[model samples]
Target: MSASDIRAEARRVLGICDACGYCNGFCDLFEAARRRSALTDADLAHLANLCHACRNCFQACQYAPPHVFAVNVPRTLARMRHQSYLDHVWPQTFAPLLNHPVATVIGVTLGAILLLFALVLAFAPAGGGLAIETGATAGAFYRVLPWTLMVGLGVLPLGWSALAIGLGWRRYWGLTRPRRATTGEARRRWCAWRTTLADILNLRNLRGGGVGCNDLDARFSPWRRWLHQTLLGGLGLSFAATLAATFYHHGLGLQAPYPLLSPPVLLGTLGGIALMIASLGLGWLEWRTAPEPIASESRRLDQAFLGLLLAVAGSGLALLLWRATPAMASLLVVHLGTVLAFFMLLPYSKFVHAGYRAIALRCESLDPVSID
Candidate 1:
């Protein structure tokens, strides 16, 4: 069935599971679901984002497939999570990203890189090839491609990504209909918020309720959790590196090509290492994961995003190692290309999972669980 059918199908499945209350402790999704009398489209969407696809409930369920209930929380929620991207994407025309998956990302990234190289060749001074070295000093990157051109190309897509995520968040938060709380309820919710924050940070749900998640089968493993955290840590560190570089340029009057011990170099080195490790590890996990419980359609998308991340991290690290040599010029172009592509696709890709899941966790925090 098409993605549009997700809401209806999920409603049916969740309706049955909610009544049974058999899988209440499987993860936060079931716990959140238990508090509600009826699951609406918005509620299901929020709940779907909260799911980590640990597959505990799917394995534990007695009414799966052959039974009339046919409750598959992981599969149904995965589809709904994907549909959220389609429904909330910016510029509407670009929403087709959900259809093309991996090919589009790879093609766009490569094309952008080639176009940039062409531009560099066309605009460089006579007898200079991308890199220009003055008498005793190192060849600074800006001499190859000026800051104006770099920022001009980057700002547009980055701005659009920020706008799209902001709008998508507004749409998602509006749908959840978080209630206004009294002081007593607010206090309890504040405590719940602390708990939810910890869960999100640690990905407690992927721990298979404690032992670990079922990656390929009923067997539990924490490898997926560690790999994902590594990716998260890498992304954060890379951003910090960029921010440090920006401050060095604008605030401190220092320029590009800082020392190895400097903030930018140190942060970028650590971040790049983490990113490479996580991207490769996650790509391997995706390759080995079975198609049964997990959503099959997301496989290509996941791989494409991970591929771009790997390219970015690898190229950045290479640029660092070869900065003193002639190779830095080409490495810079490759890194910029991959990074631009990643920022452009962030809103439409699986990258949005972090933001959407955070919103879902906040909503679940405010929700009160009733006891008999």
Candidate 2:
């Protein structure tokens, strides 16, 4: 019915969460934290970045809690993603990125170019003037074509994300209070930017990671956790590499034809593949083994989000298959469309959790600090 009702239902009924480390073994965030010395608020925040939103924990935690809680970890995480819009985080840094509109816009635009830069380089020689023309040498096309992409596809979305952060940071939209907004909206609006950002990014409040603060208790399958983390970590690495390669090749004038097979290139390629595979794999697991069905009100949106992902991955695979330079550009065009649609619609879509979970966790971090 109302939002609070939904949250209550989630923590009490729908969420099959147990405070088990079963999911820990499989979770990448957890793995990264473990690999390091002590898990900090920064560490928890990083964990949020890598979560796959797969409900494998739901299936695995069946017997841990006596009653199923209604809390949706994924959804909450999505809400916390608002923190990212407020401040642009690279997801892995876990540390705070002082909110910067220029950096946000530039970083994302560069990322888009970087993603397809390699293909562009491969086509550059074909275009003759280091600019990829339609039917030029693969080198010409590879180097030049990405500019068309960077110009035609990349700039708009990056510009928007930067705009949202810039505008939203100033409280333009946030100031327009909801008529009958609930406490949640109030908290979201009035919450101190830094504190809330920390909480949302850190995800210290989440009960699942282990703690008696919240009722959520569940054991998750290690296999699913690993799959989710591997994909997330890999993708984050891929994104970073994309930026590095672009700077090296474009800015420094080095010969780095990308989007082809090599060590790191192969790894980036593998990361994208892992994302698709993991998405499908976890989707299958959810269909086969969810603890309970989501409310009908939420089901359609949920399915739509899932369907979009399937399309993103499917389109990507199609591009890889048709990598015959000419087709690669078109395939890239399709990717830009889907991904842009995906990011722009984040707030309204089920994907919002991708942003929010860590902030909640960060709030959790403050409690212990106060207790001591």
Candidate 3:
């Protein structure tokens, strides 16, 4: 559907919901909706992001599917959430990538891999074959891909993605946040930040009014919430591992290929395993989930982003396992390529939902009437 159509549909569904008020206790989205007699485009955007797609309302909704009203809150909000990503993505030139996620992700990843291969072949020392065996020594990774070149390759794209994400977040906030300051706006915002952070860390809304999300059918399940927590935990550990590696390199003069028991290696290994498991599980859940609660158009985007996560984690683990072999150079290139592709696609992918949702949660928290 076109952008206008989506907004119009969202307005219609939310208007029905606001009038019904039956699902008000299900989530903050409803509470926020209660405060608005008529939802504006900005209000719809905020409500869309605030929805966690828990499917509780869809299952409980009296006017759902066979009824005349045919209210499907989860699916409607899912589509709107996806649209919000497209609408707010920075550097509008890349916005189209979000539409064809599978193609964009696969094409970008392959391009990065090929580019890395070309760079390796061109920069390798004279008389060396395509494969350079750099043993299991410290700093061996640098032999295949120089430290400076590798850092540059990783940093440039990452920096650009960060800037893009920050700008996109700013745009979303500008649209959703209150235009005028209240008497105690600063204090209210501070409280909202803390509340939103707690909600994010715990995947609070996924609880679906205490039972859990309706993942597969009408039955409430905690699997989705657990998988999300695992994914976030794995990402945290992986980031921590990176930080530790940096400290070891710059602070202690230690280098790459730390021992299995070392902080970086141990933490990265665990994180990689957790990421692989969570990504695979979440992908499976998405595939097996009932069609009613899902936005069919969003499957490709969700799967594409999950595939990238799996690729990065799996490749990193493989590189660690084979660092001593002649395959290390190729594996390093693959791992780095996947990492580069992930960073480049992140701002334009389903990842943006996290930032947008956080903002929505904060906005909900700042509402004058408590949702508790």
Which ten-residue region of model 2 has the weakest summed lDDT? 363-372
Q: What's the lDDT of the predicted structure labeled candidate 1?
A: 0.79
lDDT at residue 364 of model 2 (Cα atoms) = 29
lDDT of 1 at 97: 86
- Highest lDDT against the true fold, candidate: 3
RMSD to native, candidate 2: 12.5
Clashing pairs in 1: none
Highest TM-score among the candidates is held by which one? 3
RMSD of 3: 2.2
TM-scores for all candidates: the values are: 0.91, 0.51, 0.95
lDDT of 1 by residue, 213-234 (tens): 8877777889889988999999
Candidate 3 segments exceeding 4 Å error: 126-130, 183-187, 368-372
**Best of the two (1, 2) by lDDT:** 1
lDDT of 2 by residue, 129-165 (tens): 2222332223433344545654555567656655544
User: What are the Cα lDDT values of the candidates?
Assistant: 0.79, 0.44, 0.86
Candidate structures ordered by lDDT, highest first: 3, 1, 2
RMSD of 1: 2.9
Tens digits of lDDT, candidate 3, 1-372: 888888888888888987898988877778787776567778888889989999999999999999998898888888888888888999988889999999998999999999998888877655332466655778777777777888899899999999999999999998888655556578777887799899998888999888999988999999999998899989999999999999999999998978889999999999999999899999999999999878876778889999999999999999888888988888988999999999899898888888998888887777634222
